[model samples]
Target: MKCILFVFGIIALLLCATVQAVDKSACSQPHEIGPCRKADPKFFYNSEKKACEDFLYGGCKGNDNRFDTKEECEKTCL
Candidate 1:
C-alpha cells in the first residue's frame, strides 16, 4: 500500500509539472522587449490567445531583445 501510494504521488507530481501555465504578459521591462517573443501574435497556444497583445505586436525591445536565456532576458529586460 505504501509503495503504491508513493508511486501514485510521484506520477501526480510529474503530471502537474508537465502542465505549464502560459503567461501572456510575462515580460514587464520597458527596455527589454526585443528578446522575448510576443506571446501569441499570430499563433494561439492551446485555445486562449495571449493576454498582452501589445507585447506581441511590438517587437522585442531593450534588454529583452539582447539576452538569449530567460534569466538573462529577465535581468536585462526587467
Candidate 2:
C-alpha cells in the first residue's frame, strides 16, 4: 500500500511537471510581438509636440509615449 501511494505521488508530480513544461509561453521572446503591441496603435502622444500624432511601431519595443488611440493619448497628456 505504501509503495502504491509513493508511485501515485510520483506520477502526480510528473503530470504536474509535464503540464507546466507544456505551458511554457513564448510571449517573453521578441519574435512573439503580437501580444506586446497595443490592439490599436494608430496614434501616440508626443510629449515634445504636446499633441497626439502618428508614428511607426516596430511591434515589440516602444517608449512610454505610446497610446492605443488619439483620444487615449490626449486624455492623459492633454
Candidate 3:
C-alpha cells in the first residue's frame, strides 16, 4: 500500500507540473472565444501573426489566452 501511494503521489505531482506549464505558456495557445453567447471584447496572442489580435469573448469557458486589453496582451504574449 505504501508503494502504491508513493506512485500515486508521483503521478499527481507530474499532472500538477504539466498544468502549471500549460498555464505559464498560455501565450502560445490559439484564440478561443468559447461556447457562450455574450459579446465581450478581448485580446489573444496570435502565434501565426506574431501579434495580439482582438476577438469577441463569450464571457465563459475560454482558455487563458484571453486578455482584457491590447496592452495587457502585448505585455504578456509579445
Number of clashing pairs per prediction, in order: 10, 0, 0
* Candidate 2 or 1, higher TM-score: 2
- As for candidate 3, its clashing pairs are none
Residue range 11-76, candidate 1, lDDT tens digits: 998876554221323344232334555543321121132122222423444432222344543332
C-alpha lDDT of all candidate models, in order: 0.39, 0.55, 0.88
The lDDT of model 1 is 0.39
Candidates sorted by lDDT, descending order?
Answer: 3, 2, 1
How close to the true structure is residue 74 of candidate 3, measured as C-alpha lDDT?
83
Q: lDDT of model 1 at residue 64?
A: 27
Q: Candidate 3 local accuracy as lDDT?
A: 0.88
TM-score of each: 0.29, 0.42, 0.68
Best-fitting candidate, measured by TM-score? 3
Model 2: residue 42 alpha-carbon error in angstroms: 2.9
lDDT of 2 by residue, 2-78 (tens): 99999999999999888655433211212212335454435665545666776556566544555566676565556
> Residue 39 error for model 2, in Å?
13
Candidate 2 vs candidate 3, lDDT winner: 3
Model 3 stretches with alpha carbons more than 4 Å out: 1-24
TM-score leaderboard ranking: 3, 2, 1
TM-score, cand. 3: 0.68
Model 3: per-residue Cα lDDT over 22-54, one tens digit each? 655999877888999798999999999889899
Using TM-score as the yardstick, the better of models 1 and 3 is: 3
